[model samples]
Target: MSGSNKTDFTNPSTFILLGIPGLEASHVWISIPFCTMYAIAVLGNFTILFIVKMEPSLHGPMYYFLCMLAISDLVMSMSIVPKMLSIFWFNSREIDFNACLTQMYFIHCASAMDSGIFVAMALDRYVAICDPLRHSTILTNPVVAKIGLAVLLRSGLIALPLPFLVRQWPYCRTNIIRQPYCAHMAVVKLACADTSVSSYYGLFVLFCVMGLDVIFIIVSYIQILRDIFSLPTKDARLKTFGTCGSHLCAILAFYIPGLFSSLIYRFGQNIALHFHILIGTICLLLPTMLNPIIYGVRTKQIRDRVLRLFTHKGT
Candidate 1:
């Protein structure tokens, strides 16, 4: 091709995110529920952080891990929701090329970090239940801080190449992304050039992070269940099981939909594209919406703190 033709193939300065294909009529209605979910998620997570910070009794490994989880959810939710709401409510779908890449970086990195935080939470539970005596020594404050830093850095390193890889491609074809949020694969597909590098890196880090972390979490739970059942008394077993209610609820709410959505997106290409968009949106929002509620209701400490907050406010 000649230089003039090559020049004509230059990328668009901005990407127009077509929030949901074939569903523009319902976007105003859609924004109502989305706005509600986003507000709930952000407020709930911040509430958890506030309670954790204010309560001196919450300064343990379990709550430390909870703190990390709350922060991860906050980052993930904020990374996607504002732009998503903007698209839905105002049709402000046009995002600068660099801003879209920035969104992609934060969204994926925050998601990967959420997986690591869950792993950390699982380990915290395992230590608390299986080796109660060693929990403090093993998961000291300094050690927890290190684990948090490591989780963030791990995802940061893996997601570092995604923006550059996607950006280098020319968007000579479609400049519209299919989703409300700027997802890596969605953005990459809009590029006219080869997207193999970005695709492979995304898949590689996804499996590496999700694969190892989920396996370890399962193993930790197995050990936990075994330890619980081995206790001499039924009362002890019931008590131990009760302790896991919140975390288990969180795990199920998060991983099941998240994993299923991912699988369907990769393998169920024959399925309608709208289903993919809907499932992806649900998977991202549902866990975040439910997590704080689960912890607030199921964990006695958090529940008590919340009640006390209400009572004191009333007084």
Candidate 2:
């Protein structure tokens, strides 16, 4: 690429998001579902937070982690969806350089925090089921607070360098992002300078956060299942397994599509670009929408409270 073809400065003041290239004609129709999903995610997560805070019995470690997960979901969805909708509906494609980087940071940080919450949730289930005698002693209030603080610090510190790394790059190539939001790769790929450092650092962070978390979750669940099966009666086994049903649903809802979208973003060169973008979008939105619904329906305590709250309001 010649200097004549690139931007004049080392950095452009703004980047234009294309809102899923190759699907411009369907932007309006696509925004409909995206908007609906965002709305549902916001309402569902807030409802979960409110109910958890209001109910005394739900103040255990599991619900505290649930509140953290809800907060992460809200941050993740809000960081991208509003800007995405603007691009889709109003053709408001221009995002300031600083604003773009801020979006990128929040999205990745929230994702890391969400992954950590899953690990915490898994451990909570493990303690509750595998070692019921020591559950409260192990996961006391102070300990839970420390775990939450550790998660927040780890996520924020790890993601703190991303925006700075991006800002250091000379983005002279083009200012047009092909996706709906300021995805790290999408933004970094626009730089005229070498992005190998950024790419490698991103991979390092991904493995450090999500990879280790996945392994821990797998080990915890294995122990949980082993203990669950050792119970003598069939009803005992079923009851123990049922206690983990919501967490299992949440883990599946988050990790499966999230990991698939991440892999596709990195290695799916032959895949359609539009398909890739859509999958990434769904990866962020789907979990936010499904998590609260899964917990609300699967957990008896939450379900009963939700029903009672609505019934009281109707009276």
Candidate 3:
């Protein structure tokens, strides 16, 4: 079956996607849950953005980071879901080379931005904890905007070379990507060339984007723990740590699955390739969709605003 669908070396223009295997025959039915999640993801993140915008009290660094995260989540959902839905709903799993490259680039950019927002949240925590006196000064509106721009440029620069590198592949054997979306490693693995370069690039970018962020966040939290432990008053210690509880939870939800997914994809022995598609979908989609809801429930300000908005509407 694989040999029949495989591309001939002489004619390689478009890629055929197996698209979740046995489910392709039943894509329409399978797509229902995916569609529902995608819808909820959009609505949930946008609602968080709206809440942050409407509440003047949330116009600070932490909320600024939250809003940025919401925007990133929105972009992340939009990048992959529509195509994923189309693939399942309409049975069109074919993505052209240019389109595939474009998809991979934008998706990576969104992923990087999402990860960067976590770093920004860490910085906010550091300022609020380590240098309370200058928190506002350190995270001014202008500085926040500058930081956002820097994140954009940095993520773009990191993901920019990936497409060109993949384009150089001659595609001697097959163009059939087994998954619905264009994943970097999945695509690179299909290349007939020596993939050591692409693999190195992928790992390097992953370290810079996710690895370094996780390390810094851990270090920051350790310092935060030290400061909290040193506080004289019980109430002071509780209050200081209270603000970080939501962020800590958010960081865990975002990074745990991410790190596991990367490690499994890169180094795990005898792992099925299809598991990559499944795990990647879960890691990328779940956090983007759930982050806002998690924060809204965990953070008092957001909860209060949500309650007030609903109360005002009822009145």
lDDT tens digits by residue: candidate 3, 1-315: 366355546335666666676556777776776777788889888888899888899999899888888888888888888988888877777777788888899889888888888888888998899899999898999999998888888888888989888887767667888888888877887877787888889889887667887888888888989989899999999999999988888788888888888778768767766566667787888887678778989899999999999999999
For model 1, residues 144-229, the per-residue Cα lDDT tens digits are: 99998998898788778888888788777667788898888888887777778888888888777788988999999999999999
Total backbone collisions for each predicted model: 0, 0, 0
Candidates in order have lDDT scores of 0.85, 0.92, 0.82
Minimal lDDT window, size 10, model 3: 4-13
Q: Is candidate 1 or candidate 3 better by lDDT?
A: 1
Q: What is the Cα-based TM-score of model 3?
A: 0.92
**lDDT of candidate 3 at residue 235, scale 0 to 100:** 99
Candidate 2, residues 1-315, lDDT tens digits: the string is: 233236666777888899989999999999999999999999999999999999999999999999999999999999999999999989998899999999999999998999999999999999999889999999999999999999999999889999999999887668889899998888889888888999999999888779999999999999998998899999999999999999999999999998898889779999999999999999988999999999999989899999999999999
TM-score of each: 0.94, 0.97, 0.92
Error of 3 at 191 (Å): 1.7
Task: Report how far residue 306 has shifted in candidate 3, in Å.
Answer: 1.4
Give stretches of model 3 more than 4 Å off.
1-12, 267-273
Off by over 4 Å in 1: 1-7
